[model samples]
Target: MPVKITLAQAMGTCFGVQDAIDMALDPIYRGKLTVVGQLVHNPQVTERLLANGVRIVERDQIDSITTEAVMITAHGASDSTKADLQKRGFTVYDATCPLVIRLHKLARFLEREGWFPVIVGKADHVEVKGVVGNLKASAVVYHERDLEQLRGHERLGVVSQTTNRLDKVNTILDAMRKLPWVREVRFIDTVCQPVKERQAAIATLLEADIDLGIVVGGRNSANTAKLREVIADRGIAAFHVERPEEVEPRWFVTRRHVGITAGTSTPQDVIEAVYQRVREIVAQPAAADHA
Candidate 1:
């Protein structure tokens, strides 16, 4: 009696992550280039890049970098940060996702047009930081409560971190519509297509009658967290795990159907490992009720 296993259509690493790793591993960059940050959020991916001779410099320890050149993460960095790296004698290899590049430009353009820039994301997230850092003054908000921090600006400009949940972005957009004193609101939809598809896949998973959701990705991955959050909001228990062994057998005690999804930063092998572990748990004859 095999338990049914379902996988999301848009699961695993996106093209952006793949491209970043490819560029870093290429002969031209392999020995000479250092990455300014984790190329992508997945630990496995990071480890692989490290094995391939890519040096990663964390933001806190960025000053210690001695490489002649550095590759920007797929998440991107501010224009000033790029310029500063050049000034420090390191040639920059910008691996910013094209979609993210668009948002960075949109934020600057809005500021140039006199609209106050606002970012919908975690303030400390590297991607959001990069976006806001491009502007002299900008606001970052993740919820309605954060709106209180907004300075008095008659016109509002909004863009979101590419990996943020769409519902969250929409909530912020709706809030922007209600600012009575604001004369104008301009928003650019910068959410990535892969994220949107993965988010929508959550609904399909729930409709399929899965007892639980297993989200595979790095713990620091924002998009992966969003996947778990979406499933949990629908009242189904979900586990965000980086590897197969992280899935506890206790959780599968009575689960006959399980849904699996992976974040954009997750690699394909991690998802398969989790799926295999789920199957192993369900095959236990002694654990009669366990699916």
Candidate 2:
């Protein structure tokens, strides 16, 4: 049987991520640069920066960085973090996605309006942490169980991580509104447009009769993980791989029709490589074994 591959209409790296990568690889900052975190959540991007003499330091390890110049990742940093770095005599370069910066402003604006800010996102995510760092009080919730912390607040202002799934965010928001103690629920749509487009594209792709789905991106990418979750939720066999080598030949044995997608941070070359690998694997007659 011949294998047919379908690519999603919208996928791969977004503009904000590309802008950050360009800044990281800029010749002027090449030798003196230290990125405060994984610049865009892709290992390939990280490797490229390292090869070009850029240094990467974790958030807590900023004090250990010896570089005179530092860059905040596309995920962004709190105003205080940037101020402290400047106070420490380091030249700060901001590569925060414009959308994420909007989220920060909206969240802060909500806080200032006498609304208890509630972020619908992972508590430990770098972007979430950055937003929370700017606010004195806020609740981060991803599930119905996390809504307990919002019980006592009179008015709740909600915003989501830019890359969060819209469906999941809506679910959490609906749950928040159901809580008896909550009075006013004000919400802003903060999820990035790229993420929503990708999600919508994946939904459209899945409408086809695909035997399985392949999602390419960093293992830690929240948006990439959500794409896989969407595929799985539709009962399709979903394989999430960061690189071409992770694509298993055996998985395609009986699956003749494959749907492909990539995360916002995934590089185009990486996505193409994965797609080509799948083609190569399915070309082998023995690769079609049911085992």
Candidate 3:
């Protein structure tokens, strides 16, 4: 009588996350290793790295440490960060997603061609920071109101943070066209496909007859938060939990069918554990009711 649990086919870690982990574990002669930020924004993944003896250091602490190698997260880092690390005598390990790196390169190329670069993403995000860092003159616009800050720009080039919502990027592009001075606006659709696919897949899952939704990922993970938002938008009960222990019994009280989804950064094992926990939670009441 255990509650039925269905996991999204596209759930769990993407290629970028997988690549970052492999790079971190590769045996290289990095005198001392330091990671710029939460490598994949998953505590369990971070803990695994810690167990493997990788040091996760803060941005400010990077300069003070004498590590021979410093890894930029999958989210990527600004050019300034890489320069600073090198200046501090650290060998840089670029673990940035290839898609993000491609966007950075595109921004630099457009800047050289006399196009004012504009990034459609969270200004504070590491990936956006890296993209902006490559630009000599650029603007970061997260909303329609922020577009008003643009000045005297006829020719503009746009790129987005790889993790940004695709619809928001399109809306921002539409808004940018309304600017009077904008003569030509070229947009590079750089939002990562894996991230978009996961999001779209979750949206499709939500349309089905599901009782409750469980989203798994780190609290600080932006993409993970977006997945939770999508589920909550359906007005169904949804919980964002990082681990199996966070699942509550009450969530299953009236739920005969539960849906499970994980962020791009989440590992497969974590998702499985969450599913097993959900099954156990749903089974308890049915067992008691029968008794």
- Highest-scoring model, TM-score: 2
lDDT per model vs. reference: 0.87, 0.92, 0.84
TM-score for all predictions? 0.94, 0.97, 0.91
* lDDT comparison, 1 vs 2, better candidate: 2
lDDT of candidate 1? 0.87
How many angstroms is residue 122 displaced in model 3 relative to the true structure, after the best TM-score fit?
1.0
Model 2 lDDT tens row, 1-291: 788899999999999999999999999987899999899888998899999999999988988999999999899989999999999999999999999999999999999999999999999999999999999899999989998888789799999999988888888888888899988999999999999999999988878888899999999988999999999998889999999999988888778689999999999999999999988888885855743
Give me the candidate number with maximum lDDT.
Answer: 2
Error of model 3, residue 73, in angstroms: 1.9
> Which clashing pairs does model 2 show?
none
Off by over 4 Å in 2: none
**Residue-pair clashes, model 1:** 1
Colliding pairs, model 3:
68-91, 78-130
TM-score of 1: 0.94
Give the RMSD in angstroms, all C-alphas superposed, for model 2: 1.1
Model 3: runs farther than 4 Å from truth?
Answer: 27-31, 286-291
How far residue 223's Cα lies from its native spot in candidate 3, in Å, is 0.4
Per-residue alpha-carbon lDDT of candidate 1 for residues 1-291, written as tens digits (9 for 90 to 100): 566789987889998888888899897766687899788999998898888888998877779887788988999998888898888888888999998898899999999999999999999898998998899899999988888766478899998999988888998888877877777888888898889889888889999999889999999998999999999998899999998988888887667788999999998888888888888877874563643
Cα lDDT tens digits, model 3, 83-192, are 88888777898888888889889888888888899998888887887788777789999899998778788988888878888887898899899889889999988888
lDDT of 3: 0.84
* Residue 138 C-alpha lDDT in model 3: 94
